[model samples]
Target: MTVVISAIPWLVVSLVGGAAACVPLYGGNVRRFLRSSLFVKVVMWVPLFVAFVVAVSGGLLTGLVSGVLLASIGAIEWLRRDTAGRTRWYLALFVASCAVWPISTAQLAPPLWMTYCLSSVFSDVTAFFFGRYLGRHRLPDWINRDKSWEGVLGQLLGGVLGVLVLGMIFGTAPTLLAGLVIGAASAIGDLVNSVAKRIVGIEDWGSTIPGHGGVIDRFCSLNIALAAAVLLPR
Candidate 1:
């Protein structure tokens, strides 16, 4: 609760600024923009964003609850989908990572979890926005058709920006190097998830989140980002 309270101002800034910044990307096509998946994606992601903040920054009890919920949901979905057992090994690894992440981050001081989580979420947002608007070169067809160099750059920018914003709000700064590390980890996580989905011959891990496919789909970057954050010099 305290973490959430302290981060409210930062959240508002991110949300409003993101929306306003995206106006140019629409290229004056208001109706098209409203009808696009980008709008739906933003709307769907906001609620989950709050939950992630709580899980990472809301202390031991909240972390445990979030972990249990993540593990249960993830297991159910994996079992339901992977009837052929193509993903069992990966599923075990993912579930274990999900279960452990919140508990691991519980030891971090105030705003550290916030910084890491926000960096990850911001990386996703900026990557999607830039990729949608400016992507010219597609990544390898095997890795991800939707990813691009521009989007990767956006991910790095988002990471740096997240740390800078939180630094101002909390008056406790993490080095920009931490942001870069988190960003790179996030990009790798996303790519890895994409590859796994391709190997499984599926479009998403699940359809739990409306626009975002599944819980795993939404959280892959975050889990990796937090893991990377753990290695950052505190």
Candidate 2:
């Protein structure tokens, strides 16, 4: 409870900041702002550097640094450019990274957490690239076109393979199961965000991260995957 409470402010700031950033990316002034070298230098590059520092630090320090960095980036983006669709991809990546962090931290054994982290990253990265490269079969029109069965299968296979490799090293069912479940949940979270962005008619949730988008974009998968792991049995 204490940990959860402590995390709330950071979480809220991340979400709000990210949403604010998206305004510029999805707005109409993207091209005009891109031509401004000053905007790119101070507005774009600086916040990303700060986020990198915060993320690398990884603790209470991360929370404070990341929150401030995200807010600053969002504020700047909101005040500058507008480029839609691109932000969604960035957001997806961010959410995926966040999803893996808790699983990395929750393990009682350091080796187990390490294995889970490696496996989770491998699974998500493989699935993402594969899905993007080979995703031909789209879901029904009712579903978001951005998601495909190809991506889902890629996630499943990548996740299973990742867990299998990690389990071979760690030799633990609980850890393997946790990694697999978290990977699947991360994919689901990605789908949820895709749907949200589509429904809202925005691209990218925000432009806080240089390559990434907003806090929601960065942490959407992490939030869902962690929540699922916490609520589900085992």
Candidate 3:
């Protein structure tokens, strides 16, 4: 609990920053750079390596490895003539590191944390696919078309279900609230990412997650949501 409370804000800021950075990499101009073989290699491998390190280790080691990876990616992005896909790989890598470190350390209370993580995952999964398939009514033109009221509803339902189940297992209002807030926050976070990407004229963020795109692509919403859960009143 102490660790969670202390880490929440830092985590949120980092995740948000990383997500915002991805805009340049995956959004509107992606094709201009992804066409390059080097850009493809960076996007695919750098972030994954960062995630793996963070997952296996915590503390300074995680930070150190992540920093080095981000620096390398940033330098490459800057130097490479194809500025289009340049930031995508580094942004994806940074988000991956942010997510994996906390989750790996959160194993302290495996059931509770895992429940929280799983619930978040389910909510995001449902919302993403559902939004893509069923969405027709559009958001305000200012907001990304990718996000919809339908998706938010799906997220809310999924979050509520996740909280109910996890709450039953944990038998605590704090735990239940944590799940709810995190799920909602995660959905909001996703919107935040989309908005940022749209503002910068990017698309998928990065290609780190295979079908998913980037780490921010996969976990941006969840991480922010979970961070909110940690800070909320128990």
Candidate 4:
């Protein structure tokens, strides 16, 4: 039952992610870039990391491996481009935070990890559908025009619903307010990433994820949302 409940969102995200990436409305370049982004983001990374976790026990060793691996990759990318002025400190902070997520999950309780994933994944998933289907007004067309108030609605509903369902399956119910807060945090994370991308002058983070850009692109919301959850009063 736990497996089934958790899987529901994973499947939904994959389907929605694929659509968001390859949809013809965006343009040929979008489809071309995002087509690979979706699968790599959803499929390759988590499973690969999970296997790594299993091997290293997702503890200190895992953190060390993840930090070194991510930092090395970031360094390689930086070297390849070699444009120091274009890169910002926040981008480095973002990458560092990505390393934190796996470490946090390895160290923290299962519920907290699930909270972060539930909020972030469902928010993105529902936002895609809501923005595409029901969205009429684009609230902030600055970085990502597709993000709408209506999509925010979907994120809220989906986040709340996803948390409640997870709670039910686990026989532990968090406050509805907590769910709302998580949803809001997830939205803020997404917005921040959008702004970061614009400032960095990149469409997606990298082609690492086939359709999603890179680990940084896909994991930004989860990292910030997790931090917010830690800071927020329960």
lDDT per model vs. reference = 0.76, 0.52, 0.54, 0.61
The runs of at least 3 residues in candidate 1 whose Cα sits more than 4 Å from the true structure, single-residue gaps closed, are 1-3, 21-27, 56-58
Candidates' TM-scores?
0.88, 0.51, 0.56, 0.69
Q: Model 1 clash pairs? A: none
Ranking 3 against 4 by lDDT, winner: 4
Model number with the top TM-score: 1
Residue-level lDDT of model 3, residues 164-234, one tens digit each, is: 65444443333555656767877887776676566556676565456465545566665565556545563
- Please tell me which model should have the higher lDDT, number 1 or number 2: 1
- In candidate 1, where is summed lDDT lowest over 10 consecutive residues? 1-10
For all candidates, the clash counts are 0, 13, 5, 8
Residue-level lDDT of model 2, residues 12-83, one tens digit each, is: 453355334434643547555456432343244334334433343454444445445544454344334324
Q: Which candidate order results from sorting by lDDT in descending order?
A: 1, 4, 3, 2
Each prediction's RMSD over C-alphas, in Å, is 2.3, 12.3, 11.6, 5.3
For model 1, residues 1-234, the per-residue Cα lDDT tens digits are: 475567776676776776666666789676776787666766665687677666766577788888778778877877777788887877776777675565656777656677677778878887888898889988888888878989988888878887777666755688999888878888888888887777788888898887788888887777778778877888
User: Who is ahead in TM-score, 1 or 4?
Assistant: 1
For lDDT, candidate 2 versus 4, the one ahead is 4
lDDT score, residue 180, model 2? Answer: 68
